[model samples]
Target: MHLDPAIDGFARYLATERGFSVNTVRAYCADLCGLATFAEERAVGTVDGLTLELLRDWLWEGTQAGLARATIARRSASARGFTAWLTRDGVLPSDPAVRLRSPKPGRTLPRVINRTQMQDLLDKLEVAASTGDPGAVRNLAIIELLYASALRVSELVGLDVGDVDLSRLTVRVTGKGDNERVVPFGVPAQTAIVRYLQAARPALAAADPGATRSGTKPSGSALFLGSHRQRLGVRAVYRLVAALLESMPGTGPAGPHALRHTAATHLLDGGADLRAVQEMLGHASLGTTQIYTHVSAERLQQSYRLAHPRA
Candidate 1:
């Protein structure tokens, strides 16, 4: 089979059969597309023409081009998956990428905000929110919920009004691969959310008078809204978190995930159980959640260096 048709079939299989997320499928397709272009440049156009040597050379070229190790590792996985699928579908006699390998991505500690800095940030936001600006109020609520629940931006924006139980102080989040989990938040987050719902949301919703007149609520039951009263998007949440973190002291990426990392590290620092934190984070693996333990240990070491008297 031609590589193009085989790649398309593999992508469809990932989406419809494997139930991969849209972003995951897109990444897989992108890697394979790159491989296809590489193969075509080398005059290899069919699935059968994809050799183990060719796969290694493609990854080598990516390394030479200075692509991140993570990107190369992902591309290797994509090629392996594609070749395995081709073999299974009788398009190839054997998988050429069976022995394909890429360098393991280095692990770096996620950026965490110190408790004092976090407190000061929240205080400033609360003060701004007191002015009753709809955007300000909503921003406070968004940040509060993000810190309290450690939610991914996609999960945060995907929330609906019915997904939140203000009385129970919990939210139903649909995470990666459409997995659903109810995460709990504290009293402060509850207060912020209640304020947003009662004050900010209604005002933001009313900003689009045409939606009300047309009898079509553009915002629908979305828990958050843009200024135009439409459902909030991932990019908007990113910009809000990025702007807030830009002035703060941090070395890692200034994005919503930083807030998530801070929340997890803070929870671990406060003696939260590892498995429980994993559940709250909606992380499928306890190993993934263990990174925050490392963060907490590093913080403890920093404090000890600063305060201890012994040489």
Candidate 2:
């Protein structure tokens, strides 16, 4: 089969058979598409024309063009998976990527907000929410739940009204791979959520008349709605977080994931178990969770350097 058609088939397989998330499938397809373009430039457009040399040359070209190690590593993985699938499906006689290798990406510690900064930020939000502005109230609830639950923005925005258990202070989060887990939150988050639901949500929902005209409830079951009274999107949440963190001291991304990192690190600093943090993070590998341990150790060293008299 042609490489383009083969990539399309692989994408379908990833979505239907492998149960990969939409973003994962999209990323895989994007990498394959880039590979396909490169192959076409070399007049090797069919799957049969794909060889190990071509794959290596492609990665080499990416490195020469100054692509980050992480990007090159991801591309290598994408190619390996594609060729393996092709081999299994009889599209290729053998996997060309079996011998492929890429440089390992260096692991950087995630950025975390200090306890004092996080508290100050939350206090400011609380003051804004007290004015009874629906947007301010909803924003406060969003940040609280994000910090409390350590949820990915995707999971946070995907939440439905029925997913939250206010009485138990737990939220039913559908994480990556459609895995469902009930995560507990603190009283502050619970209070913020309750306030949003009671006052803010209704006000926002009333702004959308289309749903009512169509004989459906405004905002439907979405736990968080946009100003348009539709389910909130990931990009909106990213913008919200970025704006809030703009003036704050931080060296990494200012997205909602920063809150997740802060929450996990804070939990570890407070003596939470590693395995429990892993579970809360929905990380399949313990090694991923162990990175936070390193973060905590770094913080300890910093404190020791500043406070100890033996410096």
Candidate 3:
């Protein structure tokens, strides 16, 4: 079969058989398409004709093109997936990408804000909300809930009014893979959310009631609204967080995920159990959550060196 046709078949297999999400399918398809184009440029026309030499050359060309290590690694993984599937389905006698390897990228510890810095950021948000700006109130609620819940940007923006239970102080979040988890926040986030819902959300909703019917409810169900009173987008959230970080000092160029890392690390530093933090962050593996333990250990070492008398 032609390479393009085989690629399409594999994508369908991933979607139907493996039940991959649309984003995953699109990413895999893009990687495989790039590989197929590389192979075609090298005069290899069929899936069975792909060889290890061609695969290596493709990776080399990607490197030459200045692809980041992470991107190259993903492309290599895509090649392996395609070759393995072809061999398994009897389209090829062997997988050419079995031995293909990309350079391992260095694992930099995630950047987290210190406790004082976190307090300062929240203090600023509180001050902004106190100005009686409805948008400021909503922004404070957004930042508070983001840090408190350790939620991904998508999860935060995906929130609906019904997803939160102010009485219970819990939020029902649909995380990655559509997994549902109820997470709790403290009084600060609760206070901010309450203020936003009561004082800010009404003004936001009134700005664009969004296609209402006589005696029927308005269509604005999103918890966060854009200027157009539409659901807040991920980029807008990113821009807001970035702009907030610009006024704060002594922090890296980290985005909303930094807040998540900081929140998780702070939980661990405050003597919260590791496994509990893992569940709260919605991480599937406890191993992934163990990074915060390292963060805690480093902090402990710093304190010990500063306070201990022994040389």
Candidate 4:
């Protein structure tokens, strides 16, 4: 009947039964703990003491404290999910958060690089790759594959040496929820990847001579290695992409995911099937893939405004 035990059980359920990613499970746990703190303040010591009113009051308090709408909505969702789990697990006779509602967060358009700007960016990388510097070659390969395949940064870093099929010009990536898919890259990406694998990778692996004697060569089965010869972290990828996008015009995030948005938007702009992009991106829902269409339309309107002179 303890709240902590129930929370622990729910966390396990999310991780084991629901197959949620580690970060997602952590967020759910943290949100639920916030609710527990509120409940304890009201002298409610167990899961059974939760009520719909209490849940609403918690959200109201957040609003009074000037919490962002997104945070309040996420907390509401956490409560609903946790209470529903309790009812199903017989911790409660009925769900208390069945009617919980929260304010919707505003949706902003994703930043997308137009074809011309994208080309100009790659032109710079292409020039750098001509130097045959291992870092330059690897950077060219990473950005090319990222733009071509619309891969998440995690999937790009998570790739193994054998995951890439050079002959087929495809890379096998594991997306969210461990959904695996083989996505084809264009000839440019294929060329960069081939060069990196053949020359740059060996050069990087050998860069750390101490790894041979220390046996610390493989910190992970990562396709992309940091200067330390370890798996490249997502923060490093964010830093890399952010620096490249420092001068680019955009509103939303400037991380590696912006490359993903650009790839999907470009595919839609080039008349690719919506469903095909969905499959390639490994999105579980078709609606999630439709954002690119909106981006494409916004681009079209801008192009028309700039080029049309009838007004």
> Which residue window of length 10 is worst by lDDT in model 4?
211-220
The per-model lDDT (C-alpha) reads: 0.92, 0.93, 0.86, 0.88
Kindly list the per-residue Cα lDDT of model 1 for residues 207-291, writing each as its tens digit: 8566543454576799999877788989999999888888998798999999999999999999999999999999989999999
Question: What lDDT is reached at residue 25 by model 1?
Answer: 94
- The CA lDDT at 142 in model 2 is 98
lDDT score for residue 66 of model 2: 97
Best by TM-score: 2
lDDT of 4 at 36: 90
Model 1, residue 123: distance off in Å is 1.1
Provide the lowest-lDDT 10-residue window in model 3.
Answer: 210-219
Quote the lDDT for 77 in model 4.
91
Return whichever of 2 and 3 wins on TM-score: 2
**Model 3 C-alpha lDDT per residue in residues 240-277, reported as the tens digit of each score:** 88887776664565688888988999999898999888
Q: In model 4, which regions exceed 4 Å deviation?
A: 209-217
Which portions of model 1 show Cα errors greater than 4 Å? 209-217
Which ten contiguous residues of candidate 1 have the minimum total lDDT?
A: 208-217
